[model samples]
Target: MTEYKFSDRAYTKMIFHAAKYPHLAINGVLLAEKGAKSNSVVIVDAIPLFHQCLYVTPMVEIALMQVDAYAERENLVIAGYYAACENFYDNTLDKVPAAKIADKIQENFKGACFAIIDNKLVTLEQEEVALKVFSCNDGGRWSKSNYSLQNSKSTLEAVSVLLKRGAMKDVVDFDNHLDNPKHDWTNELLNKDLKQIMAMY
Candidate 1:
């Protein structure tokens, strides 16, 4: 059983991406480095891919290529995929959009995990991480998997503050970048701000 540890940057960005477009389905890739322990993956950041046309391929391919190149330069791997369903009640694996992308990620990285944003938990008052992780089995079935959040308590608190401050608007996705090349989907500024805010909690 491989363990997935999500850094505050990764977790908060995923939540922010979904929150930025509450009525649409959102998807992204997770970047990670091998953890100190065997069978552990530490997800350091998340690259938001799309909030529109979740089933499209051309855009997805282009985004993946760019993200792959960026990950390589950063010494990270695309370790996982994440999605936030448009329907508030659809948090199950079957409801995960563009699941083929996740399968492709697993094909490349056997330890790849899929994370679904739990809409009900995506609130300022929510105390727990709003993600449900799933690992694919040999039979190609996705089952719930356990994951840990780096600085769980503070991460939640920081996210709450960020939401209240309407910081989610600062999050950019591939769609935004496509509309305006200058919109940096890397979210470097947001990551830095999150780190500083999280430290205070």
Candidate 2:
């Protein structure tokens, strides 16, 4: 039998839950924040397809079920696999308008899709803790974005100065080039970061 390891909050919670409601006892379940479409799992249940976990707990199960509810009312994003990724963003994804996206996904999932509306989907599992980021203080960016390879040194130096001063810490910038303007790496970074933060919450 293959053994699945529970590595995150969602996975562990799913394991605990399966013990109580064996019918709904999914071998494993991935989680995410409420409104986020990152498909990131805060906690994860690591159950092997034909194997089992070392141990289980009811308390943990309760917590796992509560992730979505908490994210709904609090500061987290929540969405399961199909809902988070494929079914999410109906217009952009499933092509359903924001108003009817839930219903559409539910239909798509054959009436078993889990979804939480309210847009606060980014902060479900935990409270927002103000990160004390050490970043570059580059108030002199955007101007240097047009720097070329011939002048990459000066442009890079400017950004380096910003980094030295602490600019990258104030806001998020996964794939943004403070000194380069030829790259449109926005969607990838934004989506990646969104998913990453959603799972952590």
- Which is the leading candidate under TM-score? 1
Q: Find the 10 residues in a row with the least total lDDT in model 1.
A: 33-42
For model 2 the TM-score comes to 0.22
lDDT of each: 0.88, 0.25
Worst 10 residues of 2 by lDDT: 140-149
Runs with alpha carbons beyond 4 Å of true place in candidate 1? 34-38
Off by over 4 Å in 2: 1-7, 23-31, 34-69, 81-201
User: Across residues 1-201, which tens digit of lDDT does each residue of candidate 2 receive?
Assistant: 111111322322222222222222122223333333222223121111101221144433443345345444555432222111122222122221221322332232221222211112212221221011010113411110110121223323333333344333322111122224443212234334424533543
Residue clash pairs of candidate 1: none
RMSD after CA superposition, every candidate: 1.4, 22.1
Residue 161 in model 1: lDDT? 86
Query: For each candidate, how many residue pairs have backbone atoms clashing (under 3 Å)?
Result: 0, 40
Write one digit per residue (lDDT tens) for candidate 1, span 1-201. 768899999998999999999999999999887443426888899999999867788999999999999998888889999999899999888877578999999898888899999999999764988999987877887778889999898788889988988888999999999999999888888878887887788
